[model samples]
Target: METLAFIPSPSAGEIHLGPLPLRGYALCIILGVFVAVWLGGRRWVARGGQAGTVADIAVWAVPFGLVGGRLYHVITDYQLYFGEGRNPVDAVRIWDGGLGIWGAIALGALGAWIGCRRRGIALPAYADAVAPGIVLAQALGRWGNWFNQELYGRPTDLPWALKIDPEHRPVDTPDLATYHPTFLYESLWCVGVALLVIWADRRFRLGHGRAFALYVAGYTVGRFWIEYMRVDDAHHVLGMRLNNWTAIVVFLLAVVYIVVSAKKRPGREEIVEPEAEAEPEPGTDTGGPDSADADAAPEGSSAEGSSSAKEPSEDGPGRGKPSGGKPAGDGGGDGPAGAESVAKGPEPRRKAVDGPAS
Candidate 1:
């Protein structure tokens, strides 16, 4: 008998809206992806990248990840689909809920690399920015396992035990009423890992993929222990579940990467998206025709003034003298002389108004 304190499994994992079927498993995955992109975009922008770059990259990564995850699940659990009495077409039904995180991440990285290459972006920098968000996505994705009533551990009588329907229970343990909620454990672990990554990244200034490596290391540590608890049918190696070995291997790889990357690339990337040189205004010029015209305008004005001053005046030689030899004070000859006088500091007004001493 299931206790009131135990977590209850969903009665049905799908909802039919008219003729359409909405699977909780697929909905959880989609929701997780959306949240990852939204949070990753914010982080990327904080790192000096464009706002939409994460979402744009997700367009490539999401589809590739889904395919890779499905492929991995099918390949690893081939017996579940291709076994006696099972139809081969069952492998293609992803809405039925089977996805492997290792495969998703591996192929997702490839997709992200392709996307980054196309945009001329640095993948390591982007990975660091999105590390925490990725872990958060994993946390959300674990809910899908809960909805499917899968990945739970051995029978337990704990207060927080998950109550599984008899139909969904393991054949050997059909009488079991409750089991350890490994999915919940992993989900909570992922949330903690995300917070740790964020905190560590801020505290240590982790960069150049180190932040991402830290996330992987932390996640794998939890997964290693959690994998041991899961009672799901899976291939075993050396008497250990396949995922336990994977977790151990992946954890070491992440650690080594963090160390090596720190040594090889000591500091963070200076710029996420290098600012392009600003183009000049359309109607402006940098020493072009407009500049030439500007230069010529002052020269032409000065020349016109000098020529008008020196021209044999219908007045006098000194300029505007009314046909007499005496000087004219209307300042027609003051252009060049007055400018020169002012530049030399306070002198006589006569020097500005009249011509220089012969």
Candidate 2:
């Protein structure tokens, strides 16, 4: 029988930045953000939104997400800072890489809500437009982890395990032999989530906030498994792991909320006209061709209507061609029934009426 073997080590190269060193991590993040924004903006335009709306919303979401992510990282890993006599601000040293995904998403959505309100755009529509791009952006962003050699999982030697450098290795990593590539798994999972969202949107009548909720659900499901396999030292709560529990709870909540809300409430699309429509006055016209013709009818006439203008029956009484005109057969009223009334008024001094002897 063959004994288990460790995975081969991967090499790293850092570029100089004048006085600073530029790592692949930062470049990956930058490239990811650029591509994500470009794709999102294009989608927004295709979905009948303004061209710059997604870009404008990005200004808000990016900052909010960064701050939220930093805060989450610091709050969860405060022990690391106090251990080295470092201040709370040290935890915020984003240049050194510490960001929490959950906090990023929560505050990012908040920022998106604010952006939609600022521009008076439909929040759900914009949310749907950005959903896929956000997932793919996260996928690309995780490549930074591959660079920094962080967020790896339990040790494994199944040919594709990631090899981490000794200095960058997680404290619990047995001896930097190799570990399950949790970052790669999560990144690929994110890519799958993005594709699922895009395809689901095209396939069904998903509307309102369903797409956004699906995003949360899909991401949490992936995070649940990935978080459990992670060997990185992280906070634990109440016998169960923190992030793993978070993934489960958030997934359930999103699922319940989406299902209940979608079934219970009708969507907010503008389907019906309001009750109070415009109404023209009794004697005046509202400038529509029929209304204009309505007010132009001559008095004391019957069926003498003109081709250019015709009066509406709903106009003022004693108006239009039927206004007390000579009724023909029996009744003297000037309404539609007056055609047989033979009631003459101002046409001729005698009982003169012309029109096929009616």
Candidate 3:
């Protein structure tokens, strides 16, 4: 029972601030969310997206992910809440702990899709940008399990084993004081997954959701082995845990998607957000020849003015006029006719400029 080093479970998962209560589980989840958004925003901007786009999309994604995570936990472990003499209301108490990563990812993706569609962003590009951040968030989120003292693995006497309080210990292992800290294992695994995704993404330039798929595959690989060590109650299928099966299926799907996506889309997206393409650079001509003509109109007016000045002589009052005091051309004189000639002079020059521009 004696261990040289071990992680001790928190005595209490929540602390009261006067009348307010702060749960460590909730705090960890919140901190993870902030980290994800911050990192995702940076990566998104690095990929030519707007600064706030990731946070904006997360507004939709986070809520949906929380709800989906809760729903998955409640449904999968229905006996804990909906069974005989159980209070179904307890299912809504997510602060107590329990969230399914699979459900969170599935529904969170739907939310992200909605946000990306509204913002005119490609979902695959957004997924690729945020993939590493998402895995990092999962790394932080696993600490929530540590706070709750739940989801520990089989009992162990190893130096790094987690010490569980008697009250928190599973009924079947009443004498065992230490168990594998699956939370820590999963947390560390997620960090590794995040690093792997970042390195591979940079090296291979994964796009079209391939980076996201790589994260899924890497995460599920760890989850499958980690899930095997957990002693928590779970539904079993064909002698294997339901989650194990889920992990296998998800991993295979992720691998398949990575291969197919890489073949279909061979490079990283040149533009993550469509709005970037629409923004015109300063001093750049985005409007074509008509705009060029408008810009040149001022110069043409100045030229016309100079020509008009030269046309009239500085002799007597009627120097340029004929003996009968009439203008030479059909343009009446220096009145409306001269004004019209000056105005029309720019038209021919404008047309000449337009020819090459067109």
What's the distance in Å from true for residue 158, model 2? Answer: 1.0
- All candidates: TM-score: 0.79, 0.70, 0.84
* 135-192 per-residue lDDT for model 1 (tens digits): 8888988889889999999899889999999889999999988999999999999999
Q: Is candidate 1 or candidate 3 better by lDDT?
A: 3
Candidate 3: tens digits of C-alpha lDDT, residues 1-358: 6678888999899868899989989988998999999989999998888889999999999999999998889889999998789999999999999899999999999999999989999899998888988999999999998889999999988988999999989998888899999999999999999999999989988888999999999999999999999999999999999999999999999999988887888999888888876788899878887675565554445444333444345444543566675443223355776557546655534333223333
Question: Which segments of candidate 2 are over 4 A away from where they belong?
Answer: 1-21, 172-174, 265-358
Which predicted model would earn the best TM-score?
3
Better of 1 and 2 by lDDT: 1
List candidate 3 segments past 4 Å from native. 16-19, 282-291, 294-358
Looking at model 2, report the run of 10 residues with the lowest lDDT sum. Answer: 268-277
> Scored by CA lDDT, what does every candidate get?
0.82, 0.70, 0.86
Evaluation by lDDT, superior candidate among 2 and 3: 3
Kindly indicate the candidate among 2 and 3 with the higher TM-score: 3
Highest lDDT against the true fold, candidate = 3
Error of 2 at 331 (Å): 50
